[model samples]
Structure formats: C-alpha cells, structure tokens
Target chain A: DVKVTQSSRYLVKRTGEKVFLECVQDMDHENMFWYRQDPGLGLRLIYFSYDVKMKEKGDIPEGYSVSREKKERFSLILESASTNQTSMYLCASSLSYGNTIYFGEGSWLTVV
Target chain B: AQSVTQLDSHVSVSEGTPVLLRCNYSSSYSPSLFWYVQHPNKGLQLLLKYTSAATLVKGINGFEAEFKKSETSFHLTKPSAHMSDAAEYFCVVSTTGGGNKLTFGTGTQLKVEL
Candidate 1:
C-alpha cells in the first residue's frame, strides 16, 4: 500500500509566526501537491511540484509557498501565518498525470 | 480548462435506501473524472474514476458512478445506503492538458439515517 505521511496532525501558531507542514510519500511519485481545504470552498491547490527543485503555483497559491528539495518529501511553508490562513492542509502525490493521486492524512493548522 | 459541479450540497438517506449524488462537468479537452470521499477529520479517498474506458465504473465499498457524455454528467450511486456511508463526496475533473492538476467541486455531504 502507498502511504503519504504528514509530519503534523494538528498545530496552533500565533499570527505572524512562520509555519512548516511537512509531508513524505513512501511511493516514489514524481508529482507532489499541497492543497488548502475549507468549509464551502473545496480543496484548492496551493502549489505542486513535478520534479525536485521545480514548483508551480496553483489556484490559491497566495499566502503560501512550497519546497521540494528531495523527491519523496514535500513541505508547505507559511511565511507569516494569519487568522484567515487557519485551515486543513493536505499533501498529495501521484505517479504521473492522469493517475490516481494519493493523499496524506492532512495537517490542521490554527492561526491565532 | 475543466470544471466540476456537484449539484447537491447535502443529501440525506436512510439505511437500505438508494443513494444518488449528481455531478456535471465541462472540459475543453477529453476529461478524466473522479469521485472522492472524505470522512470526518480524514483525508480524501478515491472512490472511483472514469477515464473513457467504460461508461459505468464500479468503485470501493459498493459505490459506483456512470459517465454520460451526452449529459456531461458523472453521478455517483449505491444500491443501499449504509451508516458508514456518511461522508463528504467531491467530484473532480482533469484533462490531458491540465498536467496533473485537478479541478474539484464544492462537495456534497451525505447523511445516513437509521
């Protein structure tokens, strides 16, 4: 079975604090993605990386950035967390385009 | 460009009753469709996918969805609702040109009653 592991299940951070949400996939997937999920609005992609050191902005990339220094690991960085940024962050990876994208358990971040 | 729309925000069904969750999509290129289920406080799980192979696609946990090109719809259904079936369902769409990017619907919350 493929497993996508998220480092943090939950976290509380003060406004203006930097936040890091880490994800690691056991499967050697070439594509990794970070998405923000909220009520009413569905999962909006924040960023995605098809290769190490290469990233692309998604529909809702504002207020967020991502790092993929290694192939199996991807990290979402919040430069300055804010109250509006409080939401569930999900990490996903796929073998390639048009394939099943497996997802992590998700990290719930609360900004106060 | 591709987009998905889930028709119902919420659907209530009693155990042993039929279940239906409607979805419609539009894509500039040939599209691939998927239905994902998210349980409470859990990650999204792929229930089924339609990649132009077959019109009727069967998925895990007795769930299935049919693809109708004439209607541009992919509706998920099950013969009987189970208590464990209560979850949020999302309809997603992607195209060959999208390059691994998926467009998601707002989602439908399914409530199963006794």
Candidate 2:
C-alpha cells in the first residue's frame, strides 16, 4: 500500500525557535503538500512541491518554507515558531498534478 | 475563488439511524468536490469526490454524497449509522481549471449515541 510517513508525531518547541517537520512518501508522487489543521479551521494549505526543487505557496504560506531535495522527501520549516502556530501538520502526496492524494499520519506541534 | 461551507457544526444521531451532513460550495466555474473523514488524532481520509462526472458519488464506509448544481450543495448521507461512524467530516472544494488547490470548510463533528 502507498504510505506517507512523518518524521515526528508530536513536537514541542519554544517560542522563536526554528522547527522542521519532515515527510517521506513511498508512492514517488510528483506532488506533495503541507497543511495545518486546526480546530474549526479545517485544513489550510501551507506549501506544496511539484518536483524536486520546485515549490509553490499555498493560501496560508507565511513564516514557512519548504525543501524538496529528493523525490521521496519534503520538509516544512518554521522560521520562528510561535504559540499561534501550534496545530496538527499534515503531509500529502499525489501521483500527478491533479489526482487522488494520500496523507500521512500528521505531526502535532505545540509552541510555548 | 472557491469555498465550502458545512451547514452544521455538530450532528447527533442514534446508532442504526440515518446520518446527514450538510455542505455547500461557491465557485466561479465547475468545481471538484470532496468529503473527508478525520478520526480523533488521526489524519484526514478521503471519503468521496465529485468531479462533475456523476451527481451521486459513493465513498468508503458506506457513505455517499449527492452533488446538486442548482442548490450548490454536496451533502453526505448514510442510510444507517454505526457506532464507529462518529468523527469529524469536512467539505472541500477545488477549482476545475487553474490549480488544484483545495478550500475546506470548518467541518462538522458527528456524535453517535446508543
């Protein structure tokens, strides 16, 4: 079965600290995405990578950056983590630009 | 721009009863609609999608949704509710053309009682 694995299931970081969330997909999909899920807000896209070294900003891309140095891995970086950024982060990948997407288990981050 | 709205914030039902989760969307053109289920502390799973091919779409776990153009709604329904069916449901919409970025609704929490 296709699988997407996240580096961390739960994380806690101090305010103003830089944080990194990693995701790896086994499907070798061309499109990967990062979204933050919050209570009542549903899921909001943060950043997405179409290919290695290619990235696009989603609706909620702010104070965040992404890296896609390899085909299987995508990383989301928070330049300075804040309390407001605490939420569940999800990673998804699709075989093509527009197709069925698979999601990872998600990483829950708490910034104090 | 495209957007989705889940009319109900919460729905309570007894086991073996029917379930209905309301959703409405707005888009300049035709849109690709989807329903997702998120169990507690788990990732969101795709329940079903409507790509304008068919008005009625069936998803996993015996859940189905009908897309109505005149009403601009894609409401999820199930004939019978199970104890395990309690979870959060989200209505999402993506533009047909342009990019495939999805816009999600706030989501509705379903509670199943005995």
Candidate 3:
C-alpha cells in the first residue's frame, strides 16, 4: 500500500510565528500537492509541485509557499501564521494526470 | 474549466436502507469524476472514479457511482446503509486540460441511524 506520511498530526503556534508542515510519499509520485480544508470550503489547493525544485500556485496560495527539494518530500511553509490560517492541512500525491491522488492523514494547525 | 456540485448538504438514512448522494458537474471537455469519503478526523479515501471507461463504477466498501453524460451527473449509491458509512462525501472533477488539478464540491454529510 502507498503511504503518504505527514510529520505533524497537530500543532499550535502563536500568531506571527513561522510554521512548517512536512510531507513525504513512499510511492515516488511525481505530483505533490498542499491543500487547506475548512468547514464549508472543502479542500482548496494551496500549492503543488510536479518535479523537484518546481512549484505552482493553486487556487488559494496567498498565505502559503511550498518547497520540493527532493522528489519524495514536499513542504508547506507559513511565513507568519495568523488566526485565520487555523485549519486542517492535507498533503496529497499522484503519479501524473488522470491518476488517483493519495492523501495523508492531515495536519491540524491552530494559530493563536 | 470544470466544476462540481453536491446537491444535498446532508442526507440521513436508517441502517439497512438505501443510500444515495447526488452530484452534478460541468466541464469544457470530457471529465474524470471521483467520489471520496472522509471519516471523522481521518484522511480522504477514494471511494470510486469515472474515467470514461464504463458508465458504472464500483468501489470499496460496497459503494458505487454511475456516470451519465446526458445529465452530466455522477451520483453515488449503495444497496444498504451501514453505521460505519457515516462520513462526509465529496464530489470531484478534473479534465484533460486541467491536468491533475481537481475541483471539489462542498461535500455532503451522511448520517446513519438505527
């Protein structure tokens, strides 16, 4: 079975603090994504990387950035966390277009 | 561009009763549709997907969905409701032009009672 591991299952940070959420996929998938999920908004993509060192902004990318220094690892960065940024962050990966995207267990981040 | 709509925000069913979740979609090109289930505090699980192969697609946990091009709908269904089936279900759509990016519906919360 494919495993998408998220480094943190829960985190609490003060406003203005820098936050990092890490994800690693064991399947060697080429496409990796970061999505923010909220109560009524479902899942909105924040950023995605199709290759190492390459990144693309998604629908909701204003408060987030991403890094893919290695093929299996994709990281989401919050330069300065805010109360509005408190939500569940999900990491997903897929082989390519038209393939099933597998998701991680998700990291719940709370900004106070 | 592609988009998805889940008609009902919530659906309730008694155990052993049938389950149905309605979904509609619009796209500029032929689309790939998927149904995903998210259990409480858990990750999203792919229940099924439609990729133009067959109109009817069967998935894990006795769940299935049918693709109707004429109606532009992909509705999920099951023969009987199980207490364990209670969760939030999302309808997602993607197109060739859209690459791997997907548009998701707001989601429908399923509630199963005795």
**For candidate 2, lDDT tens digit of each residue in B1-114?**
888999999999999999999999999978888898999999888999988788999999999999999999999999999999999999988785537677889999999999
How good is the docking of model 2, as DockQ? 0.65
Q: What's the C-alpha lDDT at position A43 in model 1?
A: 94
Task: Provide per-model DockQ scores.
Answer: 0.82, 0.65, 0.83
Which candidate, 1 or 2, would have the higher lDDT against the true structure? 1
To one decimal place, how large is model 2's interface RMSD in Å?
A: 1.6
lDDT of 1 at A21: 97
Q: Per-residue lDDT of A40-64 in model 2, one digit per residue for the tens?
A: 7888999988899999999889989
- Which tens-of-lDDT digit does each residue in A27-49 have in candidate 3? 99999999999998899999999
Whole-structure CA lDDT of model 1: 0.95
Deviation of model 3 at B20, angstroms:
0.5
Q: What is the TM-score of chain B alone in each candidate?
A: 0.98, 0.97, 0.98
TM-score of each: 0.99, 0.96, 0.99
lDDT of 3 by residue, B1-114 (tens): 888999999999999999999999999998999999999889999999999999999999999999999999999999999999999999999898886688899999999999
List the candidate 2 regions with Cα displacement exceeding 4 Å: none
- Across residues B34-92, which tens digit of lDDT does each residue of candidate 1 receive? 99999999999999999989899999999999999999999999999999999999999
